[model samples]
Target chain A: MRVFQILTTVSYGDAVSNDCLALFELLKTSGYETYVYAENIGKQAERMGVKPYARLQKLRDDDIILYHLSTGTELNERIKALNGRKFIIYHNTTPPDVFVPYSGKLARLCSCGLDETRSLKGTFEGGFCDSDFNRQQLISYGYECPLKVRPILIPFEDYKKDPDAETLEQMGGDTKENDHKIKNVLFVGRIAPNKCQEDLISLLYAYRKMYSDPIRLILAGNPSGLEKYMAKLKVFAGELGLEDIVFTGQISFAKILAYYRSADAFVSMSEHEGFCVPLVEAMFFDVPILAYSSTAVPETLGGSGIIFDSKDPSHAARCLHEILNNKELRDLIISEQKERLKFFGYGNVSEIFMKQFKEFTGQ
Target chain B: MSTAREMLSDILLSSGAANVDVPVSFDDISVCGASSADGYLESLEREFSDRAKVIPQYRDLKEKLGGALFGFYINHSVEQQNEINARFLDVLREFKANNDEIVRLSNRLKELESRMDDNGGIR
Candidate 1:
């Protein structure tokens, strides 16, 4: 009659997995008997007490289960049949159509995942979503359960740890001085079409041709199964003669942190996002954010960071130039973002989540 | 100055005025984008052609000082570079085909061996 968390796969540093682990930690340290099970657990997460779902031999009828629902469709389809007091944490799936030009396999999975989300209607006793956009999605999908929108839990302590020194020197140079002429603009997320990485490269092109030559665009994310998309972007970058654009494919958590630390401004041209957790991450690192206003992006920023309504690379480039070179503007954006970031602090978010979790599960 | 929007508008307006006199060329860009193989080279060629118009003026002077280096390298290597790249691509394709055949044959052998083991057990 304890608590159990389940997901199809749990990899370290993944936003959904991080949220699951955060809730698991909060539950455990607060004296609730909680365990997590995943079908395919990464080495780091498996080492951190996440069990193989195959090893989950028995579950009491009264046990509470929190399922992390993301893009993976296998567990999304199976969670309903598992014997437990069920609830789903909905991390919205990317639109399948966005991946059609890149990977058929991923597109099919996302198409099926959304269908499964609809099929999961009325099955759960309760539900939760990371953002209001996802909340509205669940509503449209007919999830008439007791639902709540709690901000994703971030482990700020992990971000505070020493970033990879090798990555630091490779990116920002050996010395941490403002004397370096290059301004590094960064975008961190999955290198998928919905993220609009091609626009990032175009922005860098505009920035270089129009404003300054000594600038860099670091696109740090996992492109594990999206080789075609990555190749196309690389070709595009080459076509533009943009040599300073980097597509960092599948980096370590510390290496990613180092990129954030090295970034002068965080810019996103994404067309779709569930919550865009990296926006908050940029805030965490004090990097001023200049993002295109899209679904859930404005909601996530909550009037904190600079949200522009244009997708013209020229506009983004000019704003990026001003943000990078103008110290007064950059400081104002960061200070505003810092204040907004407190809303997503682990202490604040975890408290709301834990309070709701216990109340819903009758713990 | 006060807000990002205001600051961006300021830059946009100022830059807009500045760019009014400069007409950005898209002719060479279209031809370059027709195929990735020729994109970079074609763009460079257009730039070189523009600069070559000045080459006639300093022909005797700069060519005497090893300034024919660019023409010498291009005339010597452009055709050869294309040939080499095509050859390299063909070799890579052949290498991939050979690897695929090897994997297929190995898998077939394993299947046959497994069938033989099954027959022996039955006998």
Candidate 2:
């Protein structure tokens, strides 16, 4: 049987694109004809052998189409019209307000994506969601089809080793004073309003003001088209007279692994997360996690990390201070995260996917 | 003492008071008196009316309008403009709060000028 995957935009370093490519590999290994399609294909998409979505045509009854749904699009209507078996992989749409101050176009697209997601009540026979939070959202949207939870696919082994000498040097690892260690606080995600980099900066400000020990905060992520917001963050940091803060705008995988490996603790003040892949990555890297108790973060962490409910900068600062200073507490948190990471290992996740695929296809 | 223009600029930049040349004309006092919320709302209505008598009925007009008219320009303009607008709003609010005192001072100056005139230009 032929299996096809589709997405709105297949860009390099995107979580959905990574998931589709992994799924495509699995499908190909299983001896099924698989093709990937998207509206706009990025460079990585080309390497992954993705085709333009325009080639989607009338499919045979036995053929199956899998759509990686995140944002809103008119493609849902087209998917509903196709004569093949349809399946959806629901990636949660970001709340529109996150984009309001940055881009009205993005905000509208998110709002419309939510609307389109809601409108696709029975467009698919069944679907997979990345998290229970996203699954519940689909159910609330009146999706009555059978749905299963499949966590995002990440190459955990890529972060298993120590960062290369060049990457460590670039991130200021070697220049640090050997006499006294500087605690590294890291956050890895897109630099955007919803990710709450501003709030993280505020927490960093409070941390520096409250403590004498030197600390370096490394924010590693693509600016994600929020360059203005990123600039404002830098200015705000400057206004607060903050030092030792770095914004590594869109680094390579080696750099990402380096940030995680070198971090004393991973702190995330992001308000919105649809199964935050970075949280799991931090866990894989054995860095203790500190995240805002908002959205799917707590659920994704599954009681492994420190969850701060307050938005108060000082309160967040206090939590980070306590986590870094208390070696016993930090070790305990790291141990729990390692165990939690095991649940999302590729071996187990792939098994779950295969079971669902077999059940759906009845082959 | 700094000049009025320098003071205004200082106020625009930082919070501590500076010598600003606030024009306290008699007409300025009168203009403040006439600029109430009622008049402001009416002017807004007239402005909207002048733009287009018929408002298009759409479910997502804000998004549509932002995309069509301001999408490309406003995205670049928002960061700098937002800062200037925030500072301007702070100054405007301060001016509104001291309006009565400003009017009273203007009238007192006017009375002094009239008395001086009545005394045949103060001999």
Candidate 3:
């Protein structure tokens, strides 16, 4: 029997899209006729066999439809009408209020998304979400189906590509050996208010005050729809006299790899996430992580990295200092993070998916 | 306070950086293990952070048409958020004052301990 996954859009390098792409390839490898249909496909993804939503016709009743639920889309309404055993991969919707100030479209989309999630109560047969946090949200939304928690399938093999030469040269090859005075702390995410880039600047301000060594904050991700938020952050950083930051907006994978390779810490001040892929990425790259305990971050990290409960910049700055300056602690954290990274191991995750998938399909 | 984590906690506590009020209910949620956080590398990452730029014209025709509604509520929402932030900053101002005082007192105590250590006068 054939299987299909449908979503609003599959943008390149997005976490949800990445998971969908990996799962699509995995299903294909498993010898099932697999396809991905999205409302909009990224520029180069057409070559990868992702077809437009209009191409999704003639579905057999026995076929399976995996709908990715992360945003508001007409697909959420239309998927129920599709002829198949429909299941949803709940990526958890971002609350509308967070985006209301920046993008009314995003806000409206999220608002409609949440309402639609509730409206979709009896439509799905059985499905999975990426985190226990997401699972809980689903359960609370009154989903009665047999639900399970599956971590995102990070194609870790793809991460082994050679780091970008320019990025490596720019980072001076070995930051530790080359520059004793400067430390590189990096956060990879969009320049949205919810990601809280301003807090990174605040923490940098506090870190400089506490430590003699200066730091540069690297924020790697596209601004996407939040130009105003990014502008406000620049003004705040400037007012604080906070200089030396790199906001690499929507860079190539190789460039991102280089940042991960050269990074001392993978820091995220983001207040919301369904499953943070970068946390897994940082673990794979052996960079210690420091993240705010927001939404699914703690659940996603499990018992791996250092979790600071407060957003107080001073406390975060202190944690940064301890992780960077204390060899024993830093080493232990990295080692533990390596241990946690196995939780999202491709083999482990796929095995779990295949098991649940078998049970769900009753094959 | 003997476990590695306990020792780490002790160092942080002794230095007063562990003053963050972690709610008791949040313990089971796993916020303070070896596995959580994001850091700022003071100056080292500053150069990278300074070069932030957003690529333009990424909007498709649909997105451009939909863009008219992008920030439709920005005036009201931004104002509301600013007001809320103003209140938070007011409270934070007092919080910072107390934190600064605590830092000052902690430093003084440390200075006394150091003098005692140098003089061989502590028990």
DockQ for every prediction shown: 0.04, 0.02, 0.03
Better of 1 and 3 by DockQ: 1
Model 1 CAPRI quality: incorrect
Q: Model 2 reaches what TM-score against the true structure? A: 0.72
Off by over 4 Å in 3: A174-180, B1-7, B16-123
Q: What is the TM-score of each candidate's chain B when compared with the real chain B?
A: 0.37, 0.27, 0.32
Q: Backbone clashes in each candidate structure, one number apiece?
A: 0, 2, 34
TM-score for each predicted model, relative to the true structure: 0.78, 0.72, 0.77
Over the stretch A226-296, how does candidate 2's per-residue lDDT look in tens digits? Answer: 55456566656665666457889888877777776677778998888889998998888777788899888
- Ranking of all predicted structures according to TM-score, beginning with the best and ending with the worst: 1, 3, 2
| Superposed Cα deviation of residue A171, candidate 1 (Å) | 2.3
> Candidate 2's fnat?
0.00
Q: How would you encode candidate 2's per-residue C-alpha lDDT over B62-106 as one tens digit per residue? A: 445875876666555554555555565556556655865787899
Clash pairs, model 2 backbone: A72-A113, B4-B21
lDDT, residue B112, model 2: 76
> Candidates' lDDT values, in order?
0.78, 0.73, 0.77
